[model samples]
Target: MMTDQPALPAPPSAEPADRLLADLIALRAAVLAEAGERLARLAPGGDAGAGIHNLANYLALRGHDLRPLQRRLMSRGLSSLGRLESRVLPTLDAVIEAAAALAGAPSPTAAPDPAAFFAGETRLAAEADRLLGEAPGHRRTRIMVTLPSEAAGDPGLVIDLARRGMDVARINCAHDGSIAWRAMAAHVRTASSLTGRRLTVLMDIAGPKIRTEAVATPDKKARIAAGDAIRFVAEGEPRPTADAPFSAVVSLPDLVTRLAVGDRVRYDDGKLEGVVESLAPGEAVVRVRRAKTGGVKLKSEKGLNLPDTALGLSPLTAKDENDLATVIECADMLGYSFVSRPEDLDLLEDALARRGATESRLGLVAKIERPEAVRNLPALIARASGRRPFGVMIARGDLAAEIGFERLAEMQEEILWICEAAGVPAVWATQVLEDLVKDGVPSRGEMTDAAMAARAECVMLNKGPEVGRAIELIDRLLSRMDGHVFKKTPTLRALASW
Candidate 1:
């Protein structure tokens, strides 16, 4: 059993490092105490409020970094830091006392009341809304739609989306050039003006995307079935055809060399699955495990997911740096992708500072797609929250692939809970009502998925021919579900009479 006693007090030390440590501890205590006072209003005995306070303190005592602790409390409970201090302040005091003794200073008592930390909860929420250009009295969640490439030059289409309920317009930086991005922003501005509604433009930085580069196939598509063997070769290597068909090359050659035998590989958004059967210096042989009757076609530029291997690559690529400049110039918000560590957020902040951008004013939506990002989410959001108007995007497609399909639902819920703990909004992204947007007909399953997405602070629709109708339908469903469910909170708003 763990003992309740504190470690024996350290011998008095006059060293400079000891003094610095004491100062840091004092500063941290002050911050915590201030937070405690602010959260005191939440009523420490209240069921929900007390749980948040306890978790907050629990994380603080463990000396976990600010972000990870915040995220843990968030994923595990509710309320932001201010409300979290009620339970954490006592442990915080004990920690401070121990540090003070170690530094040879008089042992300090409990922290001052938490009043200094009492910034209202609405303060941060309002800042997020402002960054996203959300108007007063609008719905709690916003609707964002990825702009079709053609929409850059079509002001009418942009305007139509705004009229139908597009609160934020997303421009994927990976696909188009600066000219196209500028045009899309201009069209969105025009539409906002014509419709007398403001729309925020969000540009996504495509970070180190690994994809199938090309395949040695005459028909430009390679079909594979369960039990088929395929060779993954590095570019310029001797392309060896399998007994069933041809080999495929991946965009990132290094990943090919790194694949280990038995590692699971998924293609085309997890539609095709393969196991690495053998490995070579610049190639791997894979045995297909999942495929349709028509067989899965391996196409150029489709995403490749290696769930079991550590991908050795920088999170930020040269392409991302070039895109950041344009995003800063033309977008209200920037979507950060492939982030795996707190240092990655630090890199982004450094870049923003170097570019003369107002870091705090620009909305930075962190895309949670990788396992590392999820594990480090609390710290990620903590770092992000310190630097800018922050939110999260549950980038479900790659996320589902990264963590495995079986755990996608649980992962999404944990992400949502963590975001709520941080008190920041989240955007439910990828393939929401995909059929409805692409084919102008909603599938029964997708319709249910859309309703589920209403729980998030925002729902994103990928650009498609029928996105306008998709937005209309989404708006109607969201309106119906508004008072019924919100982030696990049941609303008792009166139902409409038939």
Candidate 2:
């Protein structure tokens, strides 16, 4: 964005961003060197090769620190623009700068209101009481599944996951109502009490799913560049397309007040990211700007995001209100999705407090999928601590979409670091076993991904007909990691260099 300071210098040539990544391997060593000997000793091997192990470990935890690596790469684009004044580009310096800004930037998936964020955390904490906590103190990769409707519910899936090392269960509020959940609650009680194994059920109330009301045609892999304009409905209208596609859509005028020209908006926790290009009396136009991975994308069902600064929408939706009545439950943990402000938590406490679920006994997990959510994490934690001890899930699917597919890895790690510092139990969610569950076979890359997630308290997987098998895959990969402990943390540098 800065003006050219001088005539362009020749770039390294033809290598593209991959070359920048190669340079980062060297930078990783340099950064790890800053850890000094004792911490350095923590590296898998004794030599500089240890940096690779630590870097892999850091990368695996999916923390925020690796952001530098990404920034260092994207800023490479600027270097191609040539010298800034008389200074030669530092290899891929500008790419790194952009990656840094992009990576470190708050997610467009956030709600503009601070109260709403805290409220979401508190409410989830209260709900988390019903969900399970980190068993004592050790973090394990857990399998999450929904139980059948009643005590007679098909629990073979539940038993299978447990036998295969499932640590948690989830009850989606969208499907079957409270009757189903009550059965699930009873079933969980029986299984855990009988096995003496702690089983947590997460109550995921389908909170405010935002989409363009009118149907929009699915794009075969979509692209939304900056400066493009897209249409949105004020309250949403029927469209000729089966689904409506835009950066986002707002039904509430209150939400409309939140926008400005450059503010970014997102949908589906961040499967879509766009900037507001302009606004009308009731509607605003937000152009799509980023999508990390390619997929057949559609906007049939809506999702939430921070489209601008002035939104005053309440975090608790009508659906949330309806879901709360029957599902205000006692669980080992609770997850507040699409949260952005503290007041949202207070409202939650008020809603469930009389049921006496004030978030104190519960394990609250905030799903940090938005930029503002990251910014408000400290307050969210404090509210959770004061209200109840809690945890966080760096919900990565939309998170990567919101932040930038490229920086999702780093942003997640940052969330982990912050949560660990506060002693909050963290769950790494979305796409852990995606390749395996989605494709019925694990890719070498995803295999490594699961092994790395072993560092976190919990790793979540989407439901598949073979969901239990997905859990088994995580166990299998992690088991191999433990078996090969000496080599599991191998420094790629050593093997490759030698």
Candidate 3:
């Protein structure tokens, strides 16, 4: 004899669905409002305007914590919004409509048009083709190989590289003069003609990069270790004699005068890190805090990094202006090094204009190697892409030095995502397949790194003796990865092993 009982209204099965729908609707409104506000300020138009709007939507969506919402959506067999970098609004709308349907509510809006939803990817691909040259038929990622000095004299080398799938030839103005750069450009042109393919030349204008100028040490074998004090003096100033501890002069003397006590300094690509201990009329004393196991030999010409100091140095130097005369003549693209702000790009644009180089004639690639650039990336992209075909380079060596090595992976990923949102191509640079290029053998870690680089529109390889082999390997790797991943989204192609 059981008494009739209620089933507790079936546990209100629709409650979670209703809550999810409400959250989606709220998110859509917030994202739209933010994008509208940002676009209002930009007043962008044309293709660039479309990119700016998508970027704004992406930034707004990322501004919120979506982990909880994502989990709920996944549990309900709906899209979790994990891969919406390129088309933010469309993704949000689709999710909202699906949630509404499940909750027995009217759809929030009509389904998005497939073409409009996928326009971001299409624009990005076209921009990449315009800026970095079209990708090879087999692989979507283009290869940019830095031309060795010998490439100027060795036409065979340039032709061989082109045959090996080198899409762009990079000429580093920091190392070579105008004559060499012109020769390299000529060789690249010749190779393009011979191969019947387009070969773009990118000339990297050396910015005001600080480096050790003159090193003064007690003995030829002098080395620096943890707790050792070293003095940084202005170049051409009275150097410390052998009686004093190790000392070196920096390329920029004004930077030394501006360094305050407790400022962090890194040397030799961060092999030796130090802190400012004292300052004088023309010298700043630093105490080494970290170094290699035993010590690092004091050397001249090593890069000097001031991560903690705010360097008011201009990204363009007098030499850069001089080099632009030649760069504008032959190069299809300009790689602006150490670009920290939108104003830096303005300076480059002004220089290009002065040289009568229009945006259509020369594309610009802003090298992101500073913390400021990372923080101001969105603004940088807007300023650059609004003017011309633009790309961003993850100059990881200096970037890692500026923002600790631990953050390198995370920052690079963020940069790729942001560039994709803006429909701008990104060049994955700095030591891709370094060991393989240098030693003719790929490390397991570097193979993985090369695979990751497939996300970028272009992969740059520094000049090396074995670069041909590296190009072959990277080309194959990129083709394979194309079947597996695209940006942050997994392609989910059928597993061959399975």
Candidate 4:
């Protein structure tokens, strides 16, 4: 061991905070070096600009303990990564120099460079380009339209959408069976071939969706009013006699056991609200708190959400496995629903492997819609990087409900940043231009939302009666916004006077 040398003269401006930052910088460098080595071993062919490996390696080495530091940085409003890197590197180096002088040791000369810091941004644009492909005329962003069941038989509609600048056709497996799915895929393929437009077919697998099961009522529906009590019984449990005016069974029987009293439950995407009043072994009673002006109609197969409960249900279901078999056969990309953890990714990979579908050929799009998914996003992306052509879908509907209505805006921005850091494509999804699609007229707010969605690699539009018009509007809007904005950076494009 070397002997300790005498202390040198203190720097002109040295503070305790400076010393702490310097130590952090030094530790960061060591960790980065180790992470770099691990990345090479893990994904030899991964892009250097793809920062997922870097983040993954760090997480593997240090676990989630350092996540607090990341949160603190975020809380301090370091939203612009470009700005954050520029400030962090220099400050860290200054601390290193001061610490070195005080300890009478040689300072670490090499620090994180600009190339290292901005690799994620560089790779993000590249990956997004690859996934969305180059669109015509003015826009870089692509349009993805969800296909209705009619599109399966309506070749004209498919062709029309393709001509209107729809880069992707999304088939939701939740509504239709395999027969309808095959018909839709065929139409899309034929449309692509004839139109000479490269349109991708994305199939969404419906995961364990908690929904209201068959309700035995005279009108096949029950009107629920505020302050009304209803019992959610499991499949095997007998419905309580005279339990309010109506009762319904939940699709997932296991969920009945998991719910606790006082948990807030939502129906029809929170249009109807209730709180659990009591719980039994396989049933629970909920008191409705909110409803429509006259009371809401409760229908079979409507979505049910328990926001205030810690759910133990896995994201996967037997139906998902059956659906994946069909998805693997036809779809270019698979949209996974309710994915909350990395283990869910593992289950998907295993299923794909068993079906002889390699990660390189098929694309995986993780649907971020749960509070748990939001918290574990970095790890999810890191795990996803192990596979090729992975992307993220910001399922804003369930996400908004899960995290609460108040936090949705900030949460979405955070998701965008994490996706950017991982160098993956993000699909801005759910209720985009809803009024325009449903009512054949655009809302001022929705038009603005569509413009903001232009920042994402792809904008997903749900099926509507006027969906074709919605596609045309989205295409034109994105084309105009493309020249004005590129991701988070604004491009100073000249405004058209026309």
Candidate 5:
């Protein structure tokens, strides 16, 4: 109302021009400042380097529509996080910090402005809210299966299973070659085409399929006289005079030296038991523990655990080394079996790199079965996580032996939490669907565990004698979880975040 200045023109419809300019400047400042901070975080000692998934937090902090930003960035050649947290992870915190700083400096909201970017951003924010309700796919439980070459060869099976309820299909490359996998994958494709369904195919590479040296078959049971000590015949035949209940791939030097006469030797968890009768260098002679012991089968390459003794042989096998040469592709995911050390992960990553999987679009599922792998899982996960950032599979059968059966359950749960916090997927395996495969029904204990696993990203099922029902039951269990109220989930939190 100053008389010294000429009368200003009326604003058209709404909002003054100065406020609009302020908003544009504020938004630009936000972008630049956030970019700068994120670029800084990419430096040393930042959480981004340690593999933190900060996107979710960033969106909440900045009061920005996360989904639209995500999509817009993707449209602009930015990586969509999906499950690859590391790719989109760093800038979240930076974005929030920058938004706050920009708001305070020029202050986009300081003076009322014609909603600069308000409409577009609001729409994006709404969409992000919807997406948050969907939660991360990892929130839903995942089911895993190990496909043998024979099963893989049949396309009908893969398709039917997907239609029936197979979330994921696993290919175990330890037992077959690329050609064999191709046949199975061909069927998988056929099934997908026929059913019009998406099935995530996962391949489990045989990192270390360990086994003892093979031995000749014996018709009668082998026997060591009460006082006669014999070497652990690595490459020997079972003689006609041999008489024992079962065969053992004895722990050569370690077991032979530790076991004394009258001690017990149990094979395959009491399938056969014998008493140590005598011992020699790299050898032990044991008499049968069972009364009715003649004509028992004796074979090589079997597991022999002398909980008290340490075997010199490493967990990694010659076959595992050989399998490293195999190529992996046409699958959405991968599993590194028998992983123990960071070096082991490095080796697998090298293998994956050789296969042209360095970008890590494919999920890398680590099979933590070895006790050493379990003990070193965090580091193993971190190293492999950097390469592929996929989840981990608690390969329990071997894990039980490695960490002891009593601790397996607790260990598995811990793995679940670690994977969850890191936003990595996890597949629980081994004996999960044993009863269902062996008989037609699943045990209550198994069902409970399966339900719990469904809460995880993936649950793995071994192909029983009949694979069809296994797929069906798995589908039923997973589907039922959709309406589950057992545990509080993020979808609800996302709903209430505002």
Candidate 6:
């Protein structure tokens, strides 16, 4: 037993407390100054208004390095500013007031209004309901399934999907004609009525076709391997001789002409990658840099990705303009593919306006799949949401090919945060449960991916034979994950696993 030594003086709190208060005040001022114009431009009396203001505040706040400040705040049992994505200003004000109180100094700010503090979450929920329809009673995340061509002829299939919890039906304009799309839309409507659930039909417009037009191999059976040379030729260019290097024609001739030496090119969803070895008027020779051990087949119609190239091609094509006639009539939402800028949204808006599809009538979803889109996301969100109901789809297939696989995880999280900040619904798309849907066998990785997807407002599954099973499994997964997390916040519901 030791005699009680005089209690050590509490580690001097006054200096650290004062520093925290000052840092917070400075941070608040910086946010307001940087985002003043954007805040002022937001229209009042809507979900978008407060959410956008907070988004602007968050963008500015994240511009500074706050790690040191966070550590100091944590030492004093005050907020570390780590979970302030939705309510940026309110969190700062609360932390500042607490710091002042702890230091026995005059409170620099008054208490935050409770309503203002929670408005971001409320608005985000409202926006999700408006754009994606209300989530099911059991879960907050909605499920969107791409309709296969067979869906046009099978009413039972669509109805079963609805019964299994398909909240939204996606019709890809890249595949079928208007008649088939109308049939698919009609099936969705029938399914909705039969299942007694409100379902949304989203028609995705095919932006630009950057695909392989043809493939010419010496043996016709040899696959592309690492160190192999392949020439990318333009349409109408003469095919290389059998003895010449293996060659493939690109659908976009102009794009091929613009490729410079050393530019990276990915094929078939990045299964194979190469670098430009040389460039000519109508073709570029690429040396394969990475592939499977043996080799991989290069097929016509597979997608081609140029991550290092600046492709200024418009998202709209002649085919898309024609497809809009069906989209404007049948779709509850329009998916704008490859939308990389504010102007891309404007072009689509104008087109919709010409067709008498007002903002209230159709929801617009910007499919972000390019680096430029990631860079310009804030402007794109502001432009779209300021006009009408809006959402963002993380088109991961092309995005991973563009921004590298290593950055995909980080970028998707950032995207989710920004979308949450603006009260915009994000649809987690591409390869959600590919193995299970296509082969009736789920992988451990895909199962984990599906669980992680619950953080998004919606999860999109591509068409496959066993998609109904995929839908049911993801529905259960999302429901389970719902009690554990929301956006980046971890909910501490009592755990049963202990």
Q: Which wins on lDDT, candidate 3 or candidate 5?
A: 3
Q: What's model 5's lDDT at 423?
A: 46
| Residue lDDT tens for model 4, 299-413 | 7788888877777777777888888888988888899998988888988888888888875767888999888888888767767774767889999888876766789888887
TM-score of 4: 0.79
User: Which candidate leads the pack in TM-score?
Assistant: 3
Instruction: Summarize candidate 3's per-residue lDDT along 1-498 as a digit string, tens digits.
Output: 676885432222334678888988898999899877776555455344788889989988899998767767776888648888889888888888888888899987765889987889999999999998888888889999999999889999999999988999999999979988999999999999999999999999989969887787777887888988888997675376443488888889877998999999999888899999998888888989999887998887889889889989999999999999999898989999988888888888888889888657689999999999999899898887657778999999999988888999999999999999989999999989999899999899989999999999999999999999999889888999999998888889999896
Off by over 4 Å in 5: 1-139, 212-280, 284-301, 304-326, 485-498
lDDT string, candidate 6, 285-336, tens digits: 8889998778988788999999889888989998999899999889988999
Q: Show the lowest summed lDDT stretch of 10 residues, model 4.
A: 78-87
- Candidate 3 structure, TM-score to reference: 0.94
**lDDT per model vs. reference:** 0.74, 0.56, 0.88, 0.75, 0.53, 0.87
Error of 6 at 310 (Å): 1.8
Give the Cα-based TM-score of candidate 2 against the true structure. Answer: 0.63
Task: Quote the lDDT for 196 in model 3.
Answer: 91
Ranking by TM-score: 3, 6, 4, 1, 2, 5
Candidate 5's residue-wise lDDT over 129-184, tens digit each?
A: 22111122323454556675667557766776766666567778767777777777
Give TM per candidate.
0.76, 0.63, 0.94, 0.79, 0.60, 0.93
Model 2 lDDT tens row, 1-498: 778788454433444444554454445345344534323333323442221233233332233354444344334543221211111122223344443444454322222344432332333333333435433222234555644443237555466556666667777776677767777766776677666788777777665554454443435465444434455655655222222243334455455665778887766666557777777766666666765465325455565456345465566677777676555564556677777776667777776776656545565667887667777775565555545555778878767655666787777766765554344556778777676676688788877777777655567887766666787767666654544331113323323334
Pick the lDDT winner. Answer: 3
Q: Give one clash count per candidate, in the order shown.
A: 5, 60, 0, 0, 15, 0
How many residue pairs clash in model 1? 5
Which residue runs does candidate 6 get wrong by more than 4 Å?
Answer: 1-15, 37-48, 241-244
Error of 3 at 476 (Å): 0.7
Please give, for residues 57-130, the per-residue lDDT of candidate 1 as tens digits.
44443344454333332332322433332234543454455555555777656544544232223443565576
